[model samples]
Target: MSKPNIIQLSEFDITQKIIESLSNVCTRAVLFSVKNESKDATQIAEELKISLSTVYKTLSNLEDLALAEVDKFIISPEGKKIKQYRSRIGKVEITVDNLEPSLNLYPNTDNPKSSL
Candidate 1:
């Protein structure tokens, strides 16, 4: 697979949608499962031992939140299209100061300068 072109976001860009998505256990698991490599919903469901429907729902949520994205599409022998999803953020750091929370996001790239 070729390197994914990920757009890095700054901490100031963090929003409630991102926080909510990251707070969900299922969503977090799905995000982590595809952090290192892109995978289809079926593979993620099998690896995470979750229902396919649930995986699809969580994937939709993640995509909507920009936490994860469709990295590429695979063409099966049957001429069907399959979407491979990958995590957009490599690392996420949440810090609480004076009862307020702050978020920092890192790009999901092989570049050491970009990695957390």
Candidate 2:
């Protein structure tokens, strides 16, 4: 029996999607603060120094786009609904520019190289 091979993801695949989803100021704020860890909207607002209303609205937008996910609700110390929000993917990818067009871009690179 042969084992299957695994592949890694590229920056281009997820960067644009994340950027587009996080275009809004509030959304971007939440994403930036929560870049390393999952956080609730209230916490995001506090971390970014924004209003709770704005954070909730922005998080809702992110949730709709599926770039960020809302976790199960839990009661916080303040007696408010707290739900963790984290990015759907681990990293953001962006395509490179001005390549020579003649490189083995992937594992299966049998395609003829492009001209300069």
Candidate 3:
């Protein structure tokens, strides 16, 4: 899989979306889980002890923020395709200037690893 592109969230509209993505505790946990490793949604839920539905919701939010990238799809014996998610954002910087908030994102630099 190709590396995710760096995302800058400094615009007024984008900054709000980024903030909203990281607002939930479950979402933050999901980010931490995939920071240096790729994990399927099931693994994320089990590792974080969060409900699968919550994890899925958080993953969706992160995807919208471009903070989570689909590393690959694993085909199950039943022909089901499972998506492995990795954190595309290696760093997040939030700053407030002139009463306005800005967010800066750094893309993950590490090589992709199997979700095995």
Best candidate (score: TM-score): 3
Which candidate do you rate higher for TM-score, 2 or 3?
3
Q: Write the per-residue lDDT of candidate 3 for residues 37-113, one digit (tens) a residue.
A: 78899999999898999889888878766678788899989999999998876777788899888776666676343
Q: Write the per-residue lDDT of candidate 2 for residues 6-89, one digit (tens) a residue.
A: 112222343344455545666766755654566887788788889999888877766554445654578878998878876543
Between 1 and 3, whose lDDT is larger?
Answer: 1
TM-score for candidate 1 = 0.80
In each prediction, how many residue pairs overlap at the backbone (N, C-alpha, C within less than 3 A)?
0, 5, 0
Clashing pairs in 3: none
lDDT of each: 0.78, 0.54, 0.75
Q: Which candidate is the best by lDDT?
A: 1
For residues 18-70, write the lDDT of model 1, one tens digit per residue: 77678989999998898888899999999999999999999998776667788
Give model 2's clash tally. 5
Model 2: pairs clashing at backbone N, Cα or C within 3 Å: 11-93, 11-94, 12-93, 12-94, 15-93
lDDT of 2 at 31: 56
Q: Which ten residues in a row are the worst by lDDT in model 1?
A: 3-12
* Model 1 per-residue lDDT at 20: 69
